[model samples]
Target: MTGPTVSSPHEVTDLAAVTLLVHDRTRRVLGAFLGREQTVAGAARETGLDLRVVHRDVQALRRAGLLRVTREQARAGRPVKMYRAHADDLFVDARHLPQQAGEGQAAALDPLFHHAVAREFRRALSDFSPGWGLRVYATPDAPGFAVLEGPRSARRLSPLDEWQGPPARMLSGTPTAHLTTAQVTEVQRDLILLMRKVAEFSAANAGAGQPVLLRLGLAPLTEDELRNLHR
Candidate 1:
């Protein structure tokens, strides 16, 4: 059986870093290092790219903090640097990031905020593939991952209301609200606290239950309709 794909959150902090990761050669170089450590020469061999090109691409990834220097081995007359991908996942929020760069409040928001949002977007896209299981939020309090069960598995599993002993709806609870900037900030603060509580509970019961897939997301809608609705 295939293993569950693991993803570690890595944020795109700037436009330049984003550009570098999306570049064809750099992306391949990063892919080659995922889940394993490799020397520059090994990466070049795996990618079937020129040694010089692989060296350059790896350097770029290293500069962007996307590659970790795993160790060093002396070969010939010099030490060879072994590197690995810093994260298995890259989360970029092109849709919600500020149009212009600045060092201010937006930068001060939880560094992982956009990363979580991007994970949710990724889950939505992955659901389009066949053989993928149905995605469902286990609980509103736990936002980081969703549970995925095949149709047969889903049938065996109890619904959320049955599992949690609460009335649940298949549809959303309420329409999106228009809030002031301060209100939005306050709401985010509450969400962070809730997520922390759920995380603590999850950690304490780490292996007590079956594994579930989840993607946490919280973002202000920027659609024209939403913007027009803002008070």
Candidate 2:
């Protein structure tokens, strides 16, 4: 009796993250069980795939280095294999992260992940926030961070929907100038969605805390504006 294999939403997203070289449902399914523990029957049930099908996918993922048998058991006159997600094979953390251990690991995978996330976010905006503008910006001076600015006119933002996991702030700034209630709320919100979405891509789910998004607000000041604001 082989333990079951299971798939998770996080696993599904991981496959999408590193799909540049390969895109197969089996690989994705197998990646789900690599580092994490799972039983074959459980994985079959979770992924809504047949036991035989899941087994095949697991085998395929092993060959790809996306999955490996972490453990095995014997019961009912047969041996059962337990699958764990292989660290090397996973491409994305549900937190929008790579499995690498470090601060700002997301930055390491940014060139690739950023484009994909931006594209998904843009597509999401079309239906979720029609008429809203999403801009992707990176400054040489701003290292280990990525920012997405929505149209200044947008309303409240909800990170629960936007971010795949919890997000936390690394650094935050206050808006130098007082903004209208709508502007204030909108800026505060969309900023949260974008950053929190980015934060979750780290090590949170794997003993990392539940994803928390960090919100930063800045009001860029002109020379004269700065004088007035200070006064």
Candidate 3:
């Protein structure tokens, strides 16, 4: 489906712009560049924010352990402090424990709580996403997250489901491939959108039975495919 525009593999989008702006525009910018590299000017231009603002945001990200800054002097320009995302610290997701809410109680609030939580999740994920597809979260590990795929970037995917997975370095933002921030953002958005739908389904099925046991998880891939990332 048509979705947010993607400018760079690491561009911060306007999906949940307000919340992305929660830590100010710079953190949002940092969100776009999580797990990669950039500079104040490069980030500013990519994220469509101000250079000064990018600088401030980088500082904040550094404090939040979301960014790791280094220096580089390209060709002949003065040395510049380059920034890369620390990843784990930049963003987060949660588990779908649903509190157990007792046995029958689970079904009672399943509908309302599902909707409320889904709405909150979307609002949170849409903050910096672009175009991405859906992967339902039917597990305690990696539930309701998306793996973004698009053109012109690498680092392709982000988590939309509750954080906590099988330690897949790539999914955990270890830069397994040349995935882009845009891709990650898209994945995250798709995740949120999918969950939104799930919540809708839950709402429709209220008072039906057994609280609809939905487990969240990542799309299954093979060892060869994952290993291919190096190639």
lDDT of 3 by residue, 1-106 (tens): 9999845333333333223334445556866666567777888878888778777767766765556766676666667777777542322222322233244555
State, as a TM-score between 0 and 1, how close model 1 is to the true structure: 0.39
lDDT of 1 by residue, 45-122 (tens): 989999999998888888888888999998898888889988877777775344543335456554554555456545
Report residue 42 deviation for candidate 2 (angstroms): 1.4
TM-score each candidate. Answer: 0.39, 0.31, 0.30
Cα deviation at 2, candidate 2, in Å, is 43
Clashes of 2: 33
Expressed as tens digits, the lDDT of each residue in 36-106 for candidate 2 is 78887878888888889888777766665566677789888778888876663333543654444343544
Cα lDDT listed for each candidate: 0.68, 0.57, 0.54
Best by lDDT: 1
All candidates in order of lDDT, best leading:
1, 2, 3
- Regions more than 4 Å wrong, model 3: 1-24, 74-77, 88-231
Instruction: Tell how far residue 133 is off in model 1, in angstroms.
Output: 51
